[model samples]
Target chain A: MTASSDIDALAAMILARELESALSKRADCGFQLLSSGQEAVAVGVAAALLAHDQLLCSGRSIAPALARGLDPGRVMAELIGRASGPCLGRGGRGHLSQPSAGFFGAHAVVAGNLSIAAGVALALQARRDRSIAVCMFGDGACGAGALHETMNIAALWQLPLLLVCDNNLYSVSTPRAAALAPQRLSDLAAPFGIEACTVDGMDVRVVREAAVELTDYVRNGGGPAFLECISRRYASHSTSARETRGQQELAADRELDPITRLENALLSEGALSAQTAQALREQVRAKVAAACAFADLSPLPVPEEAFADVV
Target chain B: MSSEPVRTRRVFFREAICRAVGETLDAEPNAIVMGQDVGAFGGSYKEFYGLFERFGPARVRDTPVAEAAMVGLGVGAAAAGLRTLVSITYMDFVLLALDPLVNYAAKARFKTGGQIRVPMVVKLTAGAKGQGVAHSQSLESWLMSVPGLRVVAPSNVADAYGLMRSALQADGPVVYVDHKRLFPTSGPLNASAHEVPFGLAAVSRPGRHATIVTHSYMVCVALAACDELAVSGIDCEVIDLRSLAPLDLATVCTSVSKTGALLTLEEGQVVCGIGAEIAYQAQARLGPVRVSRLGAMPAPVSSNPVLEAASLPDAGRVADAVRRLLMEG
Candidate 1:
């Protein structure tokens, strides 16, 4: 991968890690779904998108939102329910969105955003602006009827949409193998006539290459395409949920950490010195600290705000 | 010089809807219609008869029989800068698509801090027509309680056209309910462009003895009851509640104040139905007044003609309720 791409991916991973650390300590952070080990999927897919293209994701949105160029401070403000957030603190973490910045936002419902993303693609197609819509969902969403329905219509209409499945192998405590019957998640798109592929989601380089090729096909009017990124989640589903995996499995999963893998790869190639990696970490730490400070200074919305913007 | 006399053309309820939607498509370049049979088949009730031919396949598109995806796509497209009107063939089927309509479209603007607005209309055909339990329902009351949803029902051609026009132009999500039975009916339509504003009730027939407030096909039932009651030397006012969410309680209370009696009528269930809401609100505003609510029997609507007739409220039932309410002193 190019040096700039590698730096962007590393910065996103660091931001997610720092955000998770900061959010876990706050008492008023509310319920959060963190992307602890799945940073590569978000950053890599976001790298392939143009400024005009819109990206949508599931409830685990901190990584996707940050990777799609949302301000770290504003995201923090929204997460902490501050008035300065993009949604004026109304959306919180699950519904965080900034459509003007091409992040169509996240929907908490599983598989809920699939059809919505197709609709966004339909609108973009109507404009003839060649802007595509990409939706990132979990392996759990593959079992839903909405995904099938969306795929059928999307394929029939040839909407400019890219379906990215961030397969983290578990839905809460349930392992994907125990819950889903699919031999390979990418095979779900075969019947819909959509081009499909599976890749190593732990490596940002592999994820970005696959995303670029798939997005190119979609942008060139090749209809919809599906990419299954086999990744791992280092944390439980939500901050409040109990961990189902044992200590040994957790330790094994950490060995495949996307950040460590990339850092090691760059270090071996002499592309990133130990000094430079330390400097990047310090820079990311300061940025995250400033973001937290901004959120700490931001005020919460007044009680009357509950009734605002309601029709 | 003599001026030409103004003339108004009459049209079927479905044609009025067609004209209103056609006008919207003509005026707004981004407006589109999506639903089962909305394209070449011209909608289940032919409400979208000529839209496909006029707008072409691009704007007037037919979707699969998947109600969830249809509504979700419409909501998503609306939020992404396109005005869409999704048609669900039956109100009963709207349950399948409520996740998107109620959860996403209804809350998009409020949840997004007004940064995103879903300017879409979900047109559902409601009421019983011997279509059986699963296919027949009047679920407008269920949607009325949602905070950001605008619920409107049209009893005649004018309001059908007018409510749809307003719903399409509104900057939020609207549930535009049209009755299946009303599709065959016709009424006079003014040639010039006009729109009926929301939250306004039309006094279909004015009287001094009692007020019968209803909407959709029940408006016709109420008017028929008024006709029956008029012969008995009882003058009853008929108020058509065109919009259910932003209910025009002021007009209802005004009539209740003058008549000293109110009868809330609807074709849906009486328990927690439209009448229950209207009755409570009207009495809350006008103090204690003799009131009665008439609605469907507490049983499932059947396709059997006899059972269907026994399940829903009729003019006779409405008249009897009004009589009972008036006799209460």
Candidate 2:
């Protein structure tokens, strides 16, 4: 149980925030779904995963990919459609993947990766390797039939899968209450006899604790488990989508920002000094700049690349 | 020294499929089968008979009635290092699973830049046998248009065995479509293992007047029409298009060049159908050959015997279409 320290969590959050800021300034970043306010959930779940375990997520993958230990330069290159990326710029924005790094990849569809994660778990179980598959999706995916179907099958077959829902409470303008009838998103797993829990997503420690517990149960052949992290999204649904919330509401949401809260908590406890936090910010900014520089130097894929690897 | 004569045995279409899958399970340690009623029930068409008993529960799995999850599980497993075959009892039910099939399995290799390959087969049973509108459909044309999919249909027992073997060995996603009408029929199959490569059309019958191009059960219909037309001093050539995606236009052009007339027959619709593509491409290659197409009426197929017959093309309709094509040319 080598858990990530509080300082490490703060560094990961700062890196995600810096990456999101850098990506926003680029004109060629295309349609990105930034995980600006939801970094805690991504870092928390990634902290509990082993080297052999696989992690899958929805289109909002910048934070998750970075937290899962992928090379920052290659992830930047992939998002900007460069030939040097893991996917060679073929799976540009909504589909960035590098399975060798244990990040199985990101699929743009809402509930699309749920069953896929179960299948990966099935393969892992077959090998008897004790490695689990984790899928991170949004609140919008909870209403889909794919989730229910995957849950039923995963429970029936005892697949080692961890279903994490990063519930930001909005699906491009539709509130979670208006879209789903469940009192708690994790309650949906109850019907399938899956052990489930809800936690404060804005608190990195809380999210990490829940994730480690659930993943432990799954890795021990306890079948699939569900963990719902109630978080907030600071950005719009995507780069092309419009912001539907009011200014006051946005300000209130920002007050609960995971990065600021973690930094403030660490500062109050004297675990991190003001000068040290400022220096850490400068370090992350430099790292992000280096990643951007590497991506800029890489060339775009050739037009003929569209015909390659297509059976 | 002369080699011993090659031994062959006659087997039903269902038995041919069972042998191919059973052999694959025996050879490949990672291959598994998943679908509804595929375990103890031995598949709805009995095409998977003896597979569950032979492979047991771990390899031969019976899934709940969830098509989306079934396909997603297969695609995910394949991408993660397991080869899988998902059986959709009826082709119509495949619509529920297309999101995973078309979006995930089809584009996996290309999207991952060859980092991952999904060597999975989605076996679908097509055609009408009084099953009504939703259960009866020949949707091969819809799958053919997808960029990274390999669509194969087998009309006889040997092809059923050979094509399945090839599909199991393919590097990416392959849609294996079998017809309801072909299961009862039996044909000779070679004793040794064999594979029918994709993108090749077989010339079933040779003639000089006109050429009939079809696949699956429609090949039988086209052959019967050829027999009837021969009595009236008409000789028709029939070509079976085994693989629809990488269509073998060379074989079709060769047959059309000699006959100078062509009629495309299919059990599916004509608008944006297999015949339309075949006829257009054949004419483009050979330059100005007579062309006609015969297919099901543009209406929903019903369970009623008369309605089902009226909605689909029969031997008489194919014979008339061939006659009209030759007379007009």
Off by over 4 Å in 2: A1-4, B1-6
lDDT of 1 by residue, B30-90 (tens): 9999999999899999999989999999899999999999999999999999999999999
Residue B245's lDDT within candidate 1 is 88
DockQ-based class of model 2: high
Measured against the native two-chain assembly using Cα atoms, what DockQ does each of the candidate structures obtain, in the order listed? 0.87, 0.86
Candidate closest to the true structure, highest lDDT: 2
Interface RMSD of 2: 0.6
Q: How far in Å is the alpha carbon of B322 misplaced in model 2?
A: 0.3
TM-score of each: 0.98, 0.98
Residue B138 Cα positional deviation in candidate 1, in Å, after optimal superposition: 0.4
| Proportion of true inter-chain contacts also present in candidate 1 | 0.78
Candidate 1's residue-wise lDDT over A1-311, tens digit each?
Answer: 68877977888888888887888788887789999899999999999999999999999999999999999999999998999899999999789999999999999999999999999999999889889999999999999999999999999999999999999999998999998898999999999999999999999989999999999999999999999999999989998899999999999999999999999998998888999999999999899899999999999999999999999
Assess the local accuracy of residue B166 in candidate 1 as a C-alpha lDDT between 0 and 100. Answer: 92
- The alpha-carbon lDDT assigned to residue B295 of candidate 2 equals 92
Candidate 1 whole-model C-alpha lDDT, 0 to 1: 0.93
- How many collisions between residues are there in candidate 1? 0
Off by over 4 Å in 1: B1-5
**TM-score for chain B considered on its own, for each of the candidates:** 0.98, 0.98
